[model samples]
Target: MSRYAEYRALAQSLGVDAVALVPGPNFVRLMKQDFHSHERPLLLVIPAAGPVAAIVPNLELSSFAKLGFEGEVFDWMDQSGYAGAFAALARHIPLGSLAVEGQVMRVFVHHALATAFPGLKIVDAEREISGLRLRKTAEEVAALEGAIRISELALAEVLDDVRIGMTETQIEGHLIQAMFRHGASELAFGPIVAAGENSALPHAHARDVPVQPGDALLFDWGARHGGFCADITRTVFVGHASDEAQAVYETVLQANLKGHEVTRAGITAHDVDDAVTGVLEASVFADRIRTKTGHGLGREVHEAPYIMRGNRQLLEPGMVFTNEPGLYCIGGFGVRIEDDMLVTQDGCRSLTTFPKGLRILG
Candidate 1:
């Protein structure tokens, strides 16, 4: 069996003539190379039972050559545009119905394909295509561990210097620098460094507001290393915590622990989420629940096998996801504790080791 066998089978299973890949997680996984998907168009087409083919930009030919691709290459120039390449690919493979990544492929590329192959059927196979990466490999898990290590080290360094008067944006600056200093190739996403009531917003952005004595400081950040991503969120108190704040923090902490306790291979994603959310719903702050239990994590921060209600996807060994349970009171404050979880044969293991104990940072 060839390396393309799985994708070929996927194409056949999807009832499409071929599966088209753009420069994204799936493409990178197969090609083992990264290409920027900018104004130029780069496409790889894998038919169900034939040699694969590709449409490469003239400038990327040298880079694309490194892949040792066993197929015909239709290269086009900038001045001439990519229409010719697409046209040539259309003639070579003559695809009738194709599967594409709906979220990754751009509209311009879609138009180019449509124009080149008139009456071509393009099916959005986002779920099926991305689902291939749902279960992580041992190598992928190592890469994610490296990313989480860098992120945790950066967080520890940032927390050591955090004082009561520093602004949220200032703290954010410290975090970015610390991640790179700790050897992060890239940020998984923009770090969230919200303070006080701003932390109440699940996806709050850092501001210039200074940290206050009795305020909650939330940091939701991750680092990307070796093509994998690590997402971890920790909420801390600035100085002294109010009685209400401690209660809320403890409630969210137990809910996060419940997720860990219930996750294992053979369990449904819905079961893990139901067990986690059940704790929160049974709490006095049940009305404060704002988001789902968590999401799948890997090459992309968000992917398949989403951990939430109504999702029946079974949790399997080697699958990685975020066990994040948060409670937010719009104008008051929020408490969220997030951890990267790897599902094992017997149970799940937390990839994030940063302490979850409520600590007073000054």
Candidate 2:
């Protein structure tokens, strides 16, 4: 929100003058401040929309005015759809080949571009906008940090409800209640309350099966505050961890540690993934490292600079991401450790810290 200047600078880099941003100040706040609500008006607000010029949205949203957008505030009122509305909008776009968001913009309004403005060239601004959001501002980092703290508190309160003979549905309800009590705006994603062999699935949802003493419970969850989210997963043993469980958890822990160690400014996200793969390859159960090492985290739970095989994007200060490495064995069990990280100047800081070593839960 405080980055109008930054957006303008990006516009200058892209060689465009006068960006056409969709109006609705309140909606912008919702996108910036609420999870699952980040998609609205997404296509029209690319930071690189124009050079030293921002098309002020028609709808007034004073909340973001605090960020200082003292430039040209223009709009097409709902009533002026045909008069000074659309035509007025066409007049302000000064660039011959202006950039526009095509991905997240509503399909209904898309016709306005191709049919109404036959000469204007709207470039794909999604990547530029997403890239800008990949790096967290200080205020944005603080918001995520607060969200993480609340998530940790909620997880701690919900652990007691996990017991032998307890159904995954029952446990999920308790967890949701705890998250609400701690002020989570939403669940980062649906609570993953898998037990026993069900733990093998990485994205399992809470099911109706009753837990047994020997079940391996995997709690992969997150908490949302305002618009930011924190995802963390911790696998626990119902009675006593089996030998296979112990070995798999230790391997995952080693990979998570390596991922954390290599995560620093100037390093590419692929570096983290490669480091994790190295650990997994050296471990006895090497082939089971099922998913990409991790991904960048922020406004959207999953975004840019993904920690995968071929990514070359380097880490930078104020960039926030997740390091979630997992090992899954079919029909038996799985082990995972996930944490949010902030890339500082020299190294990165872990944002989710809810004890990742094996937990013996009864």
Candidate 3:
């Protein structure tokens, strides 16, 4: 059955008239169309029964039609405001309680929708919609694998030329070029090229600072392929590393490995996180830990079934998540080892394989 049909069934079960989707990863997945966001509002209405309806700007009518949209389209030109289109949509779909992506829809659009149907009851369906995409199909797993392959290939190519004195931005540029050469549809997220003291920040931005020997060069990056994403992180030394740096690297590596080791079909998401944290807490660098153990990965870089403390969500087969553990010290350096893994019937399999062992580059 089509995703829309599935969603319609879900809406019916929930006593909702229809489910609305805004332009984003979920919308792209449902429509299978690649289009940019526009100033004009566009709403896709999938009702419990009958054809779908869309309110698209006149300029984008042709592009939207590429989906061969079988539903009624209420297109409005730039000269006319979208009020009429919204009214027309309400006339067809009727304004009752409707499900919407609370996370992706803009406030202006929500207000416009409320104006269209004064009695319209908006239900936040973020969890319901996200649940639809929580598990990966065979095709999705293969696509994720392809993305990881491209990322690993890119890292290997870029690391060959990495040397001391090169700026983080330069390294980022090389990584980008290599990903494209290796056939990445796009980057999953901005490449993180944190070095030395900068690595202490979990989401540090690439700086113009020159890489120096003894610095922990942490790279957290991913590639997009077929709309699926692969996130992986590996920390390496710029040159000869200090004894302290190597020890931190080993501690994080062990935690990462333990995270994967404890991930099985019957375990809770918290179990995986606790296992990793337990490993780190036993080490001397326990207080230096940063960020959660991992998060779900797929169409969007981060999704549902987040693997962290306090989450008791069961680990099911076909579910994919990252197992990243890190130790960061201010004014010193940081070490993080991340890998994407797939939960199977028995245990979990690591999808990202960019060697977690500390490598001394330059």
Instruction: List residue ranges in candidate 1 displaced over 4 A.
Output: none
- Which candidate achieves the best TM-score against the true structure? 1
lDDT of 2: 0.71
Model 3 over residues 1-362: C-alpha lDDT tens digits? 76588889978987898889888877888888756656788989998887899999898988997897878999888898899999999888785889998888888889989999988999999878777887789999999999999999999998998988999999999998899899999999999999999999889999999999888998999999999998999999988899999898898989998987888898999999999989999999989977889999999898878989999999999999999899989888999999999999899899987877779996
TM-score of each: 0.99, 0.83, 0.96
| lDDT score at residue 217, model 1, on the 0-100 scale | 93
- Residue 99 displacement (Å), model 3: 1.3
User: What is the TM-score (0 to 1) of candidate 2?
Assistant: 0.83
Q: Find the candidate with the highest lDDT and give its number.
A: 1
Clash count per candidate: 0, 3, 0
By TM-score: ranked, best first: 1, 3, 2
Clashing pairs in 1: none
